[model samples]
Target: MPALDDLSLLIEAARRSGEIATSFTGKTAQRWDKPDDAGPVTEADLAVNAMLHQTLTAARPDYGWLSEESDDGTRRLGQRDLFIVDPIDGTRSFIEGSDTWSHSLAIARDGRITAAVVFLPMLDRLYAAAAGAGATLNGQSISVSDIATLPEATVLATKPVMEMQHWTKGDPGFKRAHRPSLAYRLGLVGQGRFDGMVTLRKSWEWDIAAGALIVTEAGGQCTDRTGQPLRFNNPDPRLNGVVAGGDAVHAALLSGLAQTQATP
Candidate 1:
Protein backbone atom coordinates (compact mmCIF):
# COMPACT_ATOMS: atom_id res chain seq x y z
CA MET A 1 0.00 0.00 0.00
CA PRO A 2 1.23 3.52 -0.72
CA ALA A 3 1.54 6.03 2.10
CA LEU A 4 -1.45 8.26 2.78
CA ASP A 5 0.62 11.28 1.86
CA ASP A 6 1.43 9.82 -1.54
CA LEU A 7 -2.20 8.94 -2.32
CA SER A 8 -3.35 12.36 -1.14
CA LEU A 9 -0.85 14.01 -3.42
CA LEU A 10 -2.05 12.01 -6.38
CA ILE A 11 -5.65 12.88 -5.60
CA GLU A 12 -4.82 16.57 -5.40
CA ALA A 13 -2.97 16.39 -8.71
CA ALA A 14 -5.95 14.66 -10.34
CA ARG A 15 -8.33 17.27 -8.96
CA ARG A 16 -6.14 20.00 -10.37
CA SER A 17 -6.08 18.33 -13.77
CA GLY A 18 -9.86 17.99 -13.63
CA GLU A 19 -10.20 21.70 -13.03
CA ILE A 20 -8.07 22.39 -16.09
CA ALA A 21 -10.31 20.16 -18.17
CA THR A 22 -13.48 21.84 -16.88
CA SER A 23 -12.21 25.25 -17.90
CA PHE A 24 -12.55 24.29 -21.58
CA THR A 25 -15.79 22.33 -21.55
CA GLY A 26 -18.02 24.87 -23.29
CA LYS A 27 -15.28 26.84 -25.03
CA THR A 28 -15.06 26.60 -28.82
CA ALA A 29 -11.35 26.98 -29.59
CA GLN A 30 -9.72 24.19 -27.57
CA ARG A 31 -10.66 21.17 -29.72
CA TRP A 32 -8.39 19.46 -32.23
CA ASP A 33 -7.47 16.06 -33.70
CA LYS A 34 -4.69 13.61 -33.01
CA PRO A 35 -2.39 12.26 -35.71
CA ASP A 36 -3.22 9.04 -37.63
CA ASP A 37 -6.93 9.91 -37.74
CA ALA A 38 -7.28 8.70 -34.16
CA GLY A 39 -10.24 11.02 -33.40
CA PRO A 40 -10.37 14.25 -31.40
CA VAL A 41 -7.84 15.62 -28.93
CA THR A 42 -8.46 19.01 -27.40
CA GLU A 43 -6.32 21.79 -25.95
CA ALA A 44 -7.88 20.90 -22.61
CA ASP A 45 -6.48 17.40 -23.01
CA LEU A 46 -2.99 18.68 -23.70
CA ALA A 47 -3.19 21.16 -20.85
CA VAL A 48 -4.31 18.53 -18.39
CA ASN A 49 -1.70 16.11 -19.71
CA ALA A 50 1.07 18.63 -19.17
CA MET A 51 -0.22 19.35 -15.68
CA LEU A 52 -0.47 15.66 -14.72
CA HIS A 53 2.90 14.74 -16.23
CA GLN A 54 4.61 17.57 -14.41
CA THR A 55 2.98 16.88 -11.05
CA LEU A 56 3.35 13.09 -11.11
CA THR A 57 6.91 13.21 -12.38
CA ALA A 58 7.80 15.71 -9.69
CA ALA A 59 6.17 13.58 -7.00
CA ARG A 60 7.67 10.26 -8.13
CA PRO A 61 10.61 11.18 -10.31
CA ASP A 62 11.57 7.58 -10.91
CA TYR A 63 8.23 6.29 -12.20
CA GLY A 64 7.74 5.97 -15.94
CA TRP A 65 4.78 7.68 -17.57
CA LEU A 66 2.16 6.65 -20.13
CA SER A 67 -0.67 8.88 -21.31
CA GLU A 68 -3.14 9.26 -24.15
CA GLU A 69 -1.74 12.48 -25.53
CA SER A 70 1.96 11.59 -25.17
CA ASP A 71 4.25 9.26 -27.07
CA ASP A 72 4.91 5.86 -25.50
CA GLY A 73 8.28 5.30 -23.84
CA THR A 74 9.40 1.92 -22.57
CA ARG A 75 11.36 3.46 -19.68
CA ARG A 76 8.38 2.71 -17.46
CA LEU A 77 9.07 -1.03 -17.72
CA GLY A 78 12.19 -0.80 -15.55
CA GLN A 79 10.38 0.96 -12.75
CA ARG A 80 7.98 -0.70 -10.32
CA ASP A 81 5.63 2.27 -10.18
CA LEU A 82 4.24 3.93 -13.31
CA PHE A 83 1.57 6.50 -13.94
CA ILE A 84 -1.06 5.65 -16.59
CA VAL A 85 -3.32 8.52 -17.52
CA ASP A 86 -6.04 9.77 -19.88
CA PRO A 87 -6.29 13.52 -19.51
CA ILE A 88 -9.69 13.55 -21.18
CA ASP A 89 -11.21 10.13 -21.47
CA GLY A 90 -14.13 11.29 -23.58
CA THR A 91 -12.78 13.93 -25.90
CA ARG A 92 -15.72 13.70 -28.30
CA SER A 93 -18.23 14.53 -25.61
CA PHE A 94 -15.93 17.21 -24.24
CA ILE A 95 -15.68 18.79 -27.69
CA GLU A 96 -19.43 18.55 -28.16
CA GLY A 97 -20.02 20.53 -24.98
CA SER A 98 -21.38 17.57 -23.04
CA ASP A 99 -20.44 16.72 -19.46
CA THR A 100 -20.00 12.96 -19.96
CA TRP A 101 -16.23 12.98 -20.28
CA SER A 102 -13.70 12.71 -17.43
CA HIS A 103 -10.05 12.55 -16.40
CA SER A 104 -8.59 9.11 -15.56
CA LEU A 105 -5.45 8.42 -13.52
CA ALA A 106 -3.89 5.25 -12.16
CA ILE A 107 -0.63 3.98 -10.69
CA ALA A 108 0.57 0.59 -11.81
CA ARG A 109 3.04 -1.35 -9.71
CA ASP A 110 4.69 -4.38 -11.30
CA GLY A 111 1.99 -4.52 -14.01
CA ARG A 112 -0.96 -4.29 -11.59
CA ILE A 113 -2.98 -1.22 -10.70
CA THR A 114 -2.35 -0.24 -7.07
CA ALA A 115 -4.35 2.96 -6.98
CA ALA A 116 -6.72 4.93 -9.22
CA VAL A 117 -8.72 8.16 -9.50
CA VAL A 118 -11.40 9.05 -12.07
CA PHE A 119 -12.54 12.64 -11.76
CA LEU A 120 -15.59 14.02 -13.59
CA PRO A 121 -14.94 17.73 -13.46
CA MET A 122 -18.27 18.86 -14.82
CA LEU A 123 -20.06 16.83 -12.17
CA ASP A 124 -17.56 17.62 -9.42
CA ARG A 125 -17.41 13.90 -8.73
CA LEU A 126 -14.15 12.24 -7.75
CA TYR A 127 -13.84 8.46 -7.73
CA ALA A 128 -10.77 7.09 -5.94
CA ALA A 129 -9.56 3.78 -4.61
CA ALA A 130 -6.43 2.18 -3.21
CA ALA A 131 -5.84 -1.54 -3.18
CA GLY A 132 -7.60 -3.22 -0.23
CA ALA A 133 -9.13 0.09 0.87
CA GLY A 134 -12.31 0.00 -1.28
CA ALA A 135 -13.58 2.79 -3.60
CA THR A 136 -15.28 6.14 -3.12
CA LEU A 137 -17.22 8.75 -5.13
CA ASN A 138 -16.83 12.36 -3.95
CA GLY A 139 -15.58 11.21 -0.52
CA GLN A 140 -18.54 8.87 -0.11
CA SER A 141 -17.94 5.13 -0.26
CA ILE A 142 -19.60 3.58 -3.32
CA SER A 143 -20.58 0.13 -4.50
CA VAL A 144 -22.44 -1.69 -7.28
CA SER A 145 -26.12 -2.54 -7.30
CA ASP A 146 -27.38 -5.98 -6.22
CA ILE A 147 -29.11 -6.87 -9.48
CA ALA A 148 -28.50 -10.57 -10.16
CA THR A 149 -30.06 -11.30 -13.53
CA LEU A 150 -29.59 -10.05 -17.07
CA PRO A 151 -33.24 -9.10 -17.37
CA GLU A 152 -32.97 -7.04 -14.23
CA ALA A 153 -29.71 -5.39 -15.21
CA THR A 154 -29.48 -1.87 -16.68
CA VAL A 155 -26.58 -2.34 -19.13
CA LEU A 156 -24.55 0.64 -20.36
CA ALA A 157 -23.44 -0.14 -23.90
CA THR A 158 -21.41 1.47 -26.66
CA LYS A 159 -21.55 1.49 -30.53
CA PRO A 160 -25.16 0.45 -30.56
CA VAL A 161 -25.28 -1.60 -33.76
CA MET A 162 -22.15 -3.60 -33.01
CA GLU A 163 -22.55 -4.07 -29.23
CA MET A 164 -26.27 -4.73 -29.51
CA GLN A 165 -25.64 -7.38 -32.14
CA HIS A 166 -23.10 -9.00 -29.88
CA TRP A 167 -25.44 -8.98 -26.85
CA THR A 168 -28.83 -9.74 -28.40
CA LYS A 169 -27.53 -12.61 -30.46
CA GLY A 170 -25.96 -13.89 -27.28
CA ASP A 171 -28.60 -13.05 -24.67
CA PRO A 172 -32.22 -12.44 -25.50
CA GLY A 173 -33.23 -11.20 -22.06
CA PHE A 174 -30.46 -8.68 -21.48
CA LYS A 175 -31.45 -4.98 -21.73
CA ARG A 176 -29.26 -2.10 -22.90
CA ALA A 177 -28.66 1.63 -22.37
CA HIS A 178 -26.19 3.72 -24.33
CA ARG A 179 -23.29 5.79 -23.00
CA PRO A 180 -20.36 6.94 -25.14
CA SER A 181 -17.28 6.99 -22.96
CA LEU A 182 -16.01 3.74 -21.45
CA ALA A 183 -14.78 5.54 -18.32
CA TYR A 184 -18.11 7.25 -17.73
CA ARG A 185 -20.02 4.00 -18.24
CA LEU A 186 -17.76 2.13 -15.81
CA GLY A 187 -17.94 4.98 -13.32
CA LEU A 188 -21.70 4.72 -13.41
CA VAL A 189 -21.42 1.07 -12.50
CA GLY A 190 -19.16 1.91 -9.55
CA GLN A 191 -21.60 4.52 -8.33
CA GLY A 192 -24.52 2.08 -8.68
CA ARG A 193 -26.08 4.21 -11.39
CA PHE A 194 -25.98 1.29 -13.82
CA ASP A 195 -26.13 -2.40 -13.17
CA GLY A 196 -23.37 -3.22 -15.67
CA MET A 197 -21.43 -2.10 -18.77
CA VAL A 198 -20.04 -3.94 -21.77
CA THR A 199 -17.56 -2.81 -24.43
CA LEU A 200 -16.62 -5.00 -27.38
CA ARG A 201 -13.67 -3.16 -28.89
CA LYS A 202 -10.06 -2.99 -27.83
CA SER A 203 -9.75 -0.05 -25.39
CA TRP A 204 -6.58 1.75 -24.38
CA GLU A 205 -4.98 1.20 -20.96
CA TRP A 206 -5.63 4.82 -20.02
CA ASP A 207 -9.30 4.25 -20.75
CA ILE A 208 -9.92 1.43 -18.28
CA ALA A 209 -7.00 1.22 -15.83
CA ALA A 210 -8.62 3.50 -13.27
CA GLY A 211 -12.19 2.55 -14.12
CA ALA A 212 -11.48 -1.16 -13.51
CA LEU A 213 -10.19 -0.59 -9.99
CA ILE A 214 -13.13 1.70 -9.31
CA VAL A 215 -15.61 -1.03 -10.29
CA THR A 216 -13.70 -3.81 -8.53
CA GLU A 217 -13.41 -1.96 -5.24
CA ALA A 218 -17.05 -0.97 -5.51
CA GLY A 219 -17.93 -4.70 -5.18
CA GLY A 220 -18.33 -5.22 -8.94
CA GLN A 221 -16.28 -7.46 -11.18
CA CYS A 222 -14.25 -6.16 -14.16
CA THR A 223 -12.66 -8.56 -16.59
CA ASP A 224 -12.16 -9.33 -20.24
CA ARG A 225 -15.24 -10.68 -21.99
CA THR A 226 -13.73 -14.13 -21.51
CA GLY A 227 -14.08 -13.59 -17.75
CA GLN A 228 -10.36 -13.24 -17.09
CA PRO A 229 -8.73 -10.61 -14.88
CA LEU A 230 -7.29 -7.47 -16.57
CA ARG A 231 -3.54 -6.80 -16.64
CA PHE A 232 -1.73 -3.51 -17.33
CA ASN A 233 1.58 -2.21 -18.76
CA ASN A 234 1.30 -4.31 -21.84
CA PRO A 235 3.26 -3.39 -24.94
CA ASP A 236 -0.03 -3.14 -26.87
CA PRO A 237 -1.70 -1.10 -24.11
CA ARG A 238 -5.15 -2.09 -25.37
CA LEU A 239 -7.73 -4.13 -23.52
CA ASN A 240 -9.29 -6.81 -25.76
CA GLY A 241 -12.80 -6.47 -24.27
CA VAL A 242 -14.56 -5.65 -21.00
CA VAL A 243 -17.48 -7.02 -18.95
CA ALA A 244 -18.15 -5.30 -15.63
CA GLY A 245 -20.95 -5.30 -13.05
CA GLY A 246 -21.98 -6.66 -9.63
CA ASP A 247 -20.93 -10.23 -8.86
CA ALA A 248 -24.20 -11.99 -9.60
CA VAL A 249 -25.11 -9.73 -12.50
CA HIS A 250 -21.71 -10.37 -14.03
CA ALA A 251 -22.10 -14.12 -13.59
CA ALA A 252 -25.58 -14.00 -15.03
CA LEU A 253 -24.29 -11.97 -17.98
CA LEU A 254 -21.57 -14.48 -18.76
CA SER A 255 -23.98 -17.34 -18.48
CA GLY A 256 -26.67 -15.68 -20.56
CA LEU A 257 -24.29 -14.79 -23.32
CA ALA A 258 -22.84 -18.27 -23.32
CA GLN A 259 -26.23 -19.99 -23.30
CA THR A 260 -27.48 -17.81 -26.13
CA GLN A 261 -24.45 -18.71 -28.17
CA ALA A 262 -24.84 -22.42 -27.44
CA THR A 263 -28.51 -22.63 -28.36
CA PRO A 264 -29.29 -23.40 -31.98
Candidate 2:
Protein backbone atom coordinates (compact mmCIF):
# COMPACT_ATOMS: atom_id res chain seq x y z
CA MET A 1 0.00 0.00 0.00
CA PRO A 2 1.13 3.57 -0.60
CA ALA A 3 1.59 6.23 2.04
CA LEU A 4 -1.32 8.22 3.48
CA ASP A 5 0.00 11.26 1.59
CA ASP A 6 -1.01 9.60 -1.68
CA LEU A 7 -4.45 8.85 -0.30
CA SER A 8 -4.76 12.43 0.90
CA LEU A 9 -4.03 13.58 -2.60
CA LEU A 10 -6.97 11.55 -3.84
CA ILE A 11 -9.18 13.16 -1.21
CA GLU A 12 -8.02 16.60 -2.26
CA ALA A 13 -8.77 15.80 -5.87
CA ALA A 14 -12.26 14.66 -4.95
CA ARG A 15 -12.90 17.86 -2.98
CA ARG A 16 -11.79 19.88 -5.98
CA SER A 17 -14.12 17.87 -8.19
CA GLY A 18 -16.93 18.55 -5.72
CA GLU A 19 -16.30 22.26 -6.05
CA ILE A 20 -16.56 21.98 -9.82
CA ALA A 21 -19.85 20.11 -9.45
CA THR A 22 -21.28 22.59 -6.95
CA SER A 23 -20.64 25.44 -9.34
CA PHE A 24 -23.27 24.05 -11.74
CA THR A 25 -25.89 22.99 -9.24
CA GLY A 26 -28.78 25.02 -10.61
CA LYS A 27 -27.46 25.93 -14.04
CA THR A 28 -29.43 24.85 -17.06
CA ALA A 29 -27.61 21.91 -18.65
CA GLN A 30 -28.24 19.11 -21.15
CA ARG A 31 -28.97 15.60 -19.88
CA TRP A 32 -28.80 12.24 -21.56
CA ASP A 33 -29.35 8.56 -20.86
CA LYS A 34 -26.96 5.67 -20.89
CA PRO A 35 -27.52 2.77 -23.27
CA ASP A 36 -28.90 0.44 -20.61
CA ASP A 37 -31.61 2.83 -19.42
CA ALA A 38 -30.43 2.04 -15.91
CA GLY A 39 -30.71 5.81 -15.16
CA PRO A 40 -30.12 9.26 -16.50
CA VAL A 41 -26.59 10.66 -16.98
CA THR A 42 -26.33 14.41 -17.27
CA GLU A 43 -23.72 16.73 -18.73
CA ALA A 44 -22.68 17.45 -15.16
CA ASP A 45 -21.70 13.83 -14.72
CA LEU A 46 -19.44 13.96 -17.76
CA ALA A 47 -17.97 17.32 -16.81
CA VAL A 48 -17.03 16.10 -13.35
CA ASN A 49 -15.79 12.81 -14.71
CA ALA A 50 -13.43 14.64 -17.00
CA MET A 51 -12.26 16.85 -14.18
CA LEU A 52 -11.62 13.91 -11.83
CA HIS A 53 -9.83 11.84 -14.45
CA GLN A 54 -7.63 14.74 -15.41
CA THR A 55 -6.77 15.68 -11.85
CA LEU A 56 -6.17 12.14 -10.60
CA THR A 57 -4.15 11.11 -13.61
CA ALA A 58 -2.07 14.21 -13.34
CA ALA A 59 -1.30 13.50 -9.70
CA ARG A 60 -0.56 9.78 -10.14
CA PRO A 61 0.06 8.97 -13.73
CA ASP A 62 0.81 5.35 -12.97
CA TYR A 63 -2.47 4.62 -11.23
CA GLY A 64 -5.14 2.95 -13.32
CA TRP A 65 -8.64 4.37 -13.52
CA LEU A 66 -12.14 2.93 -13.20
CA SER A 67 -14.91 5.48 -13.44
CA GLU A 68 -18.63 5.29 -14.19
CA GLU A 69 -18.45 7.65 -17.11
CA SER A 70 -15.33 6.08 -18.61
CA ASP A 71 -15.21 2.95 -20.70
CA ASP A 72 -14.40 -0.21 -18.79
CA GLY A 73 -10.91 -1.56 -19.40
CA THR A 74 -9.07 -4.41 -17.72
CA ARG A 75 -5.83 -2.43 -17.70
CA ARG A 76 -6.56 -1.34 -14.15
CA LEU A 77 -6.40 -4.93 -12.95
CA GLY A 78 -2.66 -5.05 -13.62
CA GLN A 79 -1.85 -1.92 -11.64
CA ARG A 80 -0.98 -1.72 -7.94
CA ASP A 81 -2.97 1.47 -7.51
CA LEU A 82 -6.36 2.17 -9.04
CA PHE A 83 -8.84 4.98 -8.71
CA ILE A 84 -12.49 3.94 -8.46
CA VAL A 85 -14.80 6.87 -8.92
CA ASP A 86 -18.37 7.83 -9.54
CA PRO A 87 -18.40 11.36 -10.94
CA ILE A 88 -21.89 12.08 -9.65
CA ASP A 89 -23.26 9.32 -7.50
CA GLY A 90 -26.82 10.57 -7.22
CA THR A 91 -27.46 11.93 -10.69
CA ARG A 92 -31.19 11.65 -10.15
CA SER A 93 -31.07 13.83 -7.07
CA PHE A 94 -28.75 16.27 -8.84
CA ILE A 95 -31.11 16.55 -11.81
CA GLU A 96 -34.08 16.93 -9.53
CA GLY A 97 -32.28 19.72 -7.66
CA SER A 98 -32.21 17.62 -4.49
CA ASP A 99 -29.37 17.97 -2.04
CA THR A 100 -28.86 14.26 -1.32
CA TRP A 101 -26.52 13.64 -4.24
CA SER A 102 -22.72 13.41 -3.91
CA HIS A 103 -19.39 12.68 -5.58
CA SER A 104 -17.75 9.38 -4.55
CA LEU A 105 -14.01 8.67 -4.77
CA ALA A 106 -11.94 5.68 -3.65
CA ILE A 107 -8.49 4.20 -4.20
CA ALA A 108 -8.10 0.43 -4.37
CA ARG A 109 -4.86 -1.41 -4.03
CA ASP A 110 -4.55 -5.10 -4.85
CA GLY A 111 -8.37 -5.41 -5.02
CA ARG A 112 -9.11 -3.81 -1.62
CA ILE A 113 -10.14 -0.22 -1.13
CA THR A 114 -7.55 1.50 1.10
CA ALA A 115 -8.84 5.07 1.00
CA ALA A 116 -12.19 6.71 0.39
CA VAL A 117 -13.79 10.15 0.04
CA VAL A 118 -17.43 11.07 -0.52
CA PHE A 119 -18.27 14.74 -0.97
CA LEU A 120 -21.82 16.07 -0.76
CA PRO A 121 -21.15 19.52 -2.15
CA MET A 122 -24.64 20.85 -1.61
CA LEU A 123 -24.55 20.04 2.11
CA ASP A 124 -20.85 20.90 2.50
CA ARG A 125 -20.21 17.48 3.98
CA LEU A 126 -16.98 15.61 3.22
CA TYR A 127 -16.61 11.99 4.33
CA ALA A 128 -13.11 10.52 4.19
CA ALA A 129 -11.19 7.49 5.45
CA ALA A 130 -7.84 5.76 5.07
CA ALA A 131 -7.09 2.20 6.09
CA GLY A 132 -6.50 2.02 9.88
CA ALA A 133 -6.74 5.81 10.15
CA GLY A 134 -10.48 5.93 11.00
CA ALA A 135 -13.24 7.86 9.21
CA THR A 136 -14.18 11.51 9.39
CA LEU A 137 -17.01 13.72 8.17
CA ASN A 138 -16.10 17.37 7.49
CA GLY A 139 -13.06 17.14 9.80
CA GLN A 140 -15.08 15.66 12.65
CA SER A 141 -14.96 11.98 13.53
CA ILE A 142 -18.20 10.02 13.07
CA SER A 143 -19.48 6.64 14.18
CA VAL A 144 -22.52 4.47 13.67
CA SER A 145 -25.55 4.28 15.95
CA ASP A 146 -25.70 1.90 18.94
CA ILE A 147 -29.17 0.50 18.38
CA ALA A 148 -29.04 -3.28 18.86
CA THR A 149 -32.53 -4.36 17.99
CA LEU A 150 -34.51 -4.06 14.78
CA PRO A 151 -37.60 -2.70 16.48
CA GLU A 152 -35.56 0.09 18.03
CA ALA A 153 -33.39 0.95 15.01
CA THR A 154 -34.08 3.30 12.15
CA VAL A 155 -33.09 1.90 8.71
CA LEU A 156 -31.98 3.97 5.71
CA ALA A 157 -32.87 1.96 2.65
CA THR A 158 -33.65 2.35 -1.05
CA LYS A 159 -36.54 1.02 -3.17
CA PRO A 160 -38.11 -0.37 -0.03
CA VAL A 161 -41.67 0.15 -1.18
CA MET A 162 -41.07 -1.72 -4.44
CA GLU A 163 -38.20 -4.22 -3.92
CA MET A 164 -38.35 -5.07 -0.23
CA GLN A 165 -41.82 -6.56 -0.08
CA HIS A 166 -40.43 -9.72 1.45
CA TRP A 167 -39.22 -7.87 4.52
CA THR A 168 -42.57 -6.23 5.19
CA LYS A 169 -44.50 -9.46 4.76
CA GLY A 170 -42.82 -11.26 7.65
CA ASP A 171 -41.60 -8.40 9.81
CA PRO A 172 -43.97 -5.62 10.65
CA GLY A 173 -41.77 -4.53 13.54
CA PHE A 174 -39.08 -2.95 11.35
CA LYS A 175 -39.18 0.63 10.04
CA ARG A 176 -37.63 1.80 6.76
CA ALA A 177 -36.67 5.31 5.64
CA HIS A 178 -36.13 6.12 1.98
CA ARG A 179 -33.03 7.90 0.66
CA PRO A 180 -32.38 8.61 -3.00
CA SER A 181 -28.72 7.73 -3.20
CA LEU A 182 -26.83 4.79 -1.71
CA ALA A 183 -23.93 7.09 -0.93
CA TYR A 184 -26.18 9.41 1.07
CA ARG A 185 -27.91 6.57 2.88
CA LEU A 186 -24.57 5.05 3.89
CA GLY A 187 -23.34 8.48 4.96
CA LEU A 188 -26.34 8.80 7.24
CA VAL A 189 -25.45 5.47 8.85
CA GLY A 190 -21.79 6.50 9.23
CA GLN A 191 -22.87 9.72 10.97
CA GLY A 192 -25.06 7.80 13.45
CA ARG A 193 -28.13 9.48 11.99
CA PHE A 194 -29.50 6.10 10.90
CA ASP A 195 -29.12 2.80 12.65
CA GLY A 196 -28.95 0.64 9.51
CA MET A 197 -29.13 0.44 5.71
CA VAL A 198 -30.03 -2.45 3.38
CA THR A 199 -30.39 -2.85 -0.38
CA LEU A 200 -31.75 -5.97 -2.07
CA ARG A 201 -30.97 -5.09 -5.67
CA LYS A 202 -27.61 -4.89 -7.40
CA SER A 203 -25.56 -1.68 -7.48
CA TRP A 204 -22.32 -0.50 -8.99
CA GLU A 205 -18.97 -0.74 -7.19
CA TRP A 206 -18.33 3.01 -7.39
CA ASP A 207 -21.65 3.67 -5.70
CA ILE A 208 -20.79 1.95 -2.40
CA ALA A 209 -17.00 1.44 -2.06
CA ALA A 210 -16.16 4.77 -0.41
CA GLY A 211 -19.29 4.82 1.74
CA ALA A 212 -18.76 1.21 2.83
CA LEU A 213 -15.29 2.01 4.11
CA ILE A 214 -16.65 5.08 5.88
CA VAL A 215 -19.31 3.02 7.63
CA THR A 216 -16.82 0.36 8.72
CA GLU A 217 -14.22 2.84 9.94
CA ALA A 218 -16.96 4.59 11.92
CA GLY A 219 -17.51 1.38 13.95
CA GLY A 220 -20.14 -0.10 11.67
CA GLN A 221 -20.19 -3.20 9.45
CA CYS A 222 -21.09 -3.53 5.75
CA THR A 223 -21.60 -6.69 3.69
CA ASP A 224 -23.49 -8.24 0.86
CA ARG A 225 -26.99 -9.78 1.20
CA THR A 226 -25.48 -13.02 2.51
CA GLY A 227 -23.44 -11.13 5.12
CA GLN A 228 -20.15 -11.23 3.23
CA PRO A 229 -17.53 -8.46 3.12
CA LEU A 230 -17.41 -6.39 -0.06
CA ARG A 231 -14.66 -6.74 -2.71
CA PHE A 232 -13.67 -4.36 -5.52
CA ASN A 233 -12.33 -4.63 -9.12
CA ASN A 234 -14.12 -7.88 -9.77
CA PRO A 235 -14.95 -9.10 -13.26
CA ASP A 236 -18.62 -8.54 -12.49
CA PRO A 237 -19.22 -4.93 -11.48
CA ARG A 238 -22.65 -5.39 -9.92
CA LEU A 239 -23.13 -5.61 -6.13
CA ASN A 240 -26.05 -7.43 -4.57
CA GLY A 241 -27.74 -7.17 -1.19
CA VAL A 242 -25.84 -4.57 0.88
CA VAL A 243 -26.39 -4.71 4.67
CA ALA A 244 -24.76 -2.12 6.89
CA GLY A 245 -25.12 -0.75 10.43
CA GLY A 246 -23.65 -0.64 13.90
CA ASP A 247 -22.36 -3.95 15.31
CA ALA A 248 -25.45 -5.29 17.02
CA VAL A 249 -27.82 -3.57 14.64
CA HIS A 250 -25.95 -5.07 11.68
CA ALA A 251 -26.34 -8.51 13.19
CA ALA A 252 -30.06 -8.09 13.79
CA LEU A 253 -30.63 -6.63 10.35
CA LEU A 254 -28.79 -9.52 8.66
CA SER A 255 -30.78 -11.99 10.72
CA GLY A 256 -34.02 -10.38 9.63
CA LEU A 257 -32.88 -10.46 6.03
CA ALA A 258 -32.03 -14.12 6.42
CA GLN A 259 -35.50 -14.88 7.70
CA THR A 260 -37.04 -12.93 4.86
CA GLN A 261 -34.97 -14.83 2.30
CA ALA A 262 -35.76 -18.17 3.90
CA THR A 263 -39.49 -17.58 3.95
CA PRO A 264 -41.07 -19.17 0.88
The lDDT of each candidate is 0.81, 0.81
Worst 10 residues of 2 by lDDT: 255-264
User: What is candidate 1's TM-score against the reference?
Assistant: 0.91
Q: Which candidate is the best by TM-score?
A: 2
**What is candidate 2's local distance difference test score?**
0.81
- State the lDDT of candidate 2 residue by residue for 1-264, as single tens digits: 464776688678877887777777543657887886768888889989998899888988998888889999778778888888999988888888888788898988777778888888888888988888888998899999988788898887654523445443466355779878788788889999999988877778898888898899899999987787898887766676688999998887776663334211
Write candidate 1's Cα lDDT for 191-239 as tens digits: 9999998776677889998889889989999987768789898887887
Clashes of 2: 0
Which residue pairs in candidate 1 collide?
A: none
